[model samples]
Structures are given as structure tokens and as C-alpha cells.
Target: MLLLLPVLPTPEFWITLGNYVGLYSIVAIGLVLLTGVGGMTSFGQAAFVGLGAYSTAYLTTQFGLSPWFCLLVGLVITMASAYV
Candidate 1:
């Protein structure tokens, strides 16, 4: 005997929720790489996240790049930045 909530999410809500889950999954994977096996201490997770934000901004505003291409550019830039 369980009660159901009166208001349920619409289709758009479901779509948005799904998108967030996918994005979060990627970020969680990155955290694992940075902390779990790499054993890197993070005083700068926000900086890494900011790098991603800038990459998205630059790709969208400067280059008119697609999201997928922007993601690739961001990954390469982040890895290179970390190495240096």
C-alpha cells in the first residue's frame, strides 16, 4: 500500500533528467581517473571544471563548433594543460 505523488514529470522533464545523468556519469568517471587509480589529490577540481566551461564557451562563441567537437577539443586541452 504505497501512495503515489500527485504531480509527475512530463516528457520534457524526463529528457532533461536523462541528459543530466549522462553528463554526471562522465564527470564521475573523470573523478575516478583523477583520484582512484591516478591517486591525484585535488585542490583544484573547480579549476578543472572551469576549464571545461571555458572550452564550451570558446567553441560555441568563437568557433561555432558542434558540441561533440567542442567536447573533444576540451578533452585534449585539459590533458595537455595537466601535463604541462
Candidate 2:
């Protein structure tokens, strides 16, 4: 990435890849906590991540809502879904 600093206009793709890697790292942590500690496997963490991401993306793009407000909304949606 550093090598492309002068050759490329910007490293947007690398930045996006880094974001996805970070997101999946959290997923891995969640899986280890649940499977190793509880002795069971589940994809709940990834599901919640997708739910929150979709909710926030939709709200922000369609309604032009503030990211912070959309974040709160997404959290609420995810928690409600998790509870039920």
C-alpha cells in the first residue's frame, strides 16, 4: 500500500479491504469466544454484523440520515432481532 502512494491516485480499495478485514477479525473473536468457551458453533455474530450493516446502509442512503443516528438505529435493530 505504501509503495502505491505515489503511483496511484488513492488507495481506496486497500482502505476498504482493511475495513472488511477488521470486521471479519471481530467475527473470528466472537466465534472463538462462543465455540471455545461454550462448546457450540453458531453464525450469530456474522448475522448480526450483516443486519446492522444493511440497516445502517439503507437508512443513511435512502433517508440521508446522520451516521451516528443510523448507528443507534442499527444497534437497536440488531439487539431487537437478537432478543427475539
Question: Per-model C-alpha lDDT, please?
Answer: 0.77, 0.87
Tens-place lDDT per residue, model 2, 1-84, is 767765867678877787789868977787888899988978777799899989999999999999779989999999999999
The TM-score of candidate 1 is 0.61
lDDT score at residue 11, model 2, on the 0-100 scale: 75
Candidate 1 lDDT score at position 20: 86
* 22 Cα displacement, candidate 1 (Å): 1.6
The stretch of ten residues in a row with the least summed lDDT in candidate 1 is 1-10
Stretch of 10 with least lDDT, candidate 2? 1-10
> TM-scores of the models, in the given order?
0.61, 0.64
Task: In model 2, state the lDDT of residue 75.
Answer: 91
The residue-by-residue lDDT of candidate 1 on 1-84, one tens digit each, is 113322554478766787789878877887899899899978687687779768977987888888778978887887788778
